[model samples]
Target: MHVLILGGTTEGRLLAGLLDGTVRVTSSLAGRVAAPRLPAGEVRIGGFGGPEGLAAWVRRHDVDAVIDATHPFAERISFNAARAAATAHVPLLVLRRPGWVPVAGDRWHEVGSLEEAAAALDGLGDRVFLTSGRLGLAAFADRPEWFLVRSVDAPDAPMPARSELLLDRGPFTLDGERGLLARHRIDVLVTKDSGGAATAPKLTAAREAAVPVVVVRRPPVPQGVPVASTPEEAAAWARALAG
Candidate 1:
């Protein structure tokens, strides 16, 4: 049995680790990051042209199933995978981690998109901690709020005029997050609901500091497709197929 994983996420990597050696697994990455953490399987980096191209590749490679385990905010690729899987007549599963829900003492402003997130930041506070990744910074570029843009890579132009870039990767500690918020004097945080435990300490810090957060809600996965919320669940699906 052969499986193609459209993966650039921790969950994807975990799934690959689970299925490697048991079945043939191939993981594809978009290669937007300078250096991405590799999964434990045959890995291909770059776009497969588009949906048509992806379908062609699936047919050519004789892929039995496809699991899209990309970032939750990766809206375009998810849709493309849906189309490709349907065209190729292979089973498709989307592995999206669950979104974070606000708890007691959490001030959450949930919006549908980055543009809306920028709007939600209006009057929320300045000194914004923008962690929605580098690509979406353009939406907040013209906003008057000063931004602390933290991303794995330094963002390109069209970022906020009064923003300072902080390049860092996640699995951030709560203490570290607390210190960062204090050092930057961040009053409001703008982030996507790209949910995971490693990337969630900042939310806790924000909550502890009584800071407001503007969360850009994740786009819905393409409809009529099976969805798994964990790598374990996705691995089970793959193993079932293999059996």
Candidate 2:
């Protein structure tokens, strides 16, 4: 049995590792990062064109099932996968990590888009920790506040005029996150609702520091794909389909 894992997230990597020996898994990455942490098994980098291209690849490779395990905010790829799976007549499963919910003492301002997040930041603070990744920095370009934009890779142009770029990856620790907020004197945080334990310590630090957070809500996933919240559940569904 063969499966194509549209992978890049930690969950995708975990699922691929789990199914490596038991099932034939081909993990595909978008190659946005300079050096991504690769999943075990057959891995391919770069785009598969679009939906039509992905469908062709599925047919050519005889893929039995597909798991759309890309990042939650990666709406374009998720939509393409949905279309490609339907065109190829392959069962598709979407594995999305659940979004974070605000708890007691958590000052979270949820917005629909990056532009809205930028709006939400107005008068919030001058020193901002923008952890919303590298793609949407253009929205904050004209803002008067200073920003500390952090991402896995250095971002492209149209970033904030008064911001500093920090290249890093997570599983960030609570102590480390708190230290950054303190050292940078960050009064506000801008981030996406990219829920996972890996980068969640920042949220905790913000809560502890009483810093307001502007969270850009994740874009809706393409409908009609069966969804799973965990890699274990996704693997189970794939196993059933592959069988």
Candidate 3:
């Protein structure tokens, strides 16, 4: 009953805790984050090469089932997991949290992709609070707006010409969110619809302050895989496979 989780998220860590003692669990992280919080059980860091390499690993390691519990915006790995699981002839489940939805009085401008979000920012505001991850800063590089870019790691070049980096991680507080918005005088916010409460306070603060938001929509999971919306539900799926 060995289960391999393609995980680097909060739900993935929680799922490892839920199944730690009951079965043989192994969590795989992408190693993008410098100091990622580890889950219980065996852990492997770095890529599995590609889908073919991942399928080979499954065969070599005798993994019984595969669970994809990656970040919502992690498009490449999700598709790779789907292909690897199918090739390995194992049960696969996609543990994806739901995307964020705008509430009443929220000025949300939703876009299909990062490029579109970047384009939408032109009409939104000049002082931008961009929380759309470090790697994506290139999309906003050519825009004239001043950006307050936040990430756990400092972003590489090709970012906005007038951007200041704010290095931080989250589970951010509402008070802090309010303070950041006020101190920076941010009139527009740009983020991905990476759902969950860890960094959701910014959206709340944006709504209260009457700031416009440009949200990049999350990419879809593979078409045929079964999807679970929570760690508990994903754990149930694993338990059924174990039984």
TM-score of each prediction: 0.98, 0.98, 0.99
What does candidate 1's lDDT look like per residue over 70-168, in tens digits?
999888899999999999999999999999999999999999988998888778997999998989778988999888889998788898999888999
Clashing pairs in 3: none
Per-residue CA lDDT of model 3 for 38-124, tens digit only, reads 999999999999999999999999999999999998999999989999999998999998888899989999999889998898777
Residue pairs with clashing backbones, model 1: none
Residue pairs clashing in model 2 are: none
User: For model 2, how does the per-residue alpha-carbon lDDT over 179-216 read when each residue is reduced to its tens digit?
Assistant: 99999999999999999999999999999999999998
The residue-level lDDT of candidate 3 at 84 comes to: 93
Error of 2 at 47 (Å): 0.4
Show how many residue pairs clash in every candidate, following the order shown: 0, 0, 0
Instruction: Return the number of clashes found in candidate 2.
Output: 0
Off by over 4 Å in 3: none
Best by lDDT: 3
> What are the runs in model 1 whose C-alpha is more than 4 Å off?
none
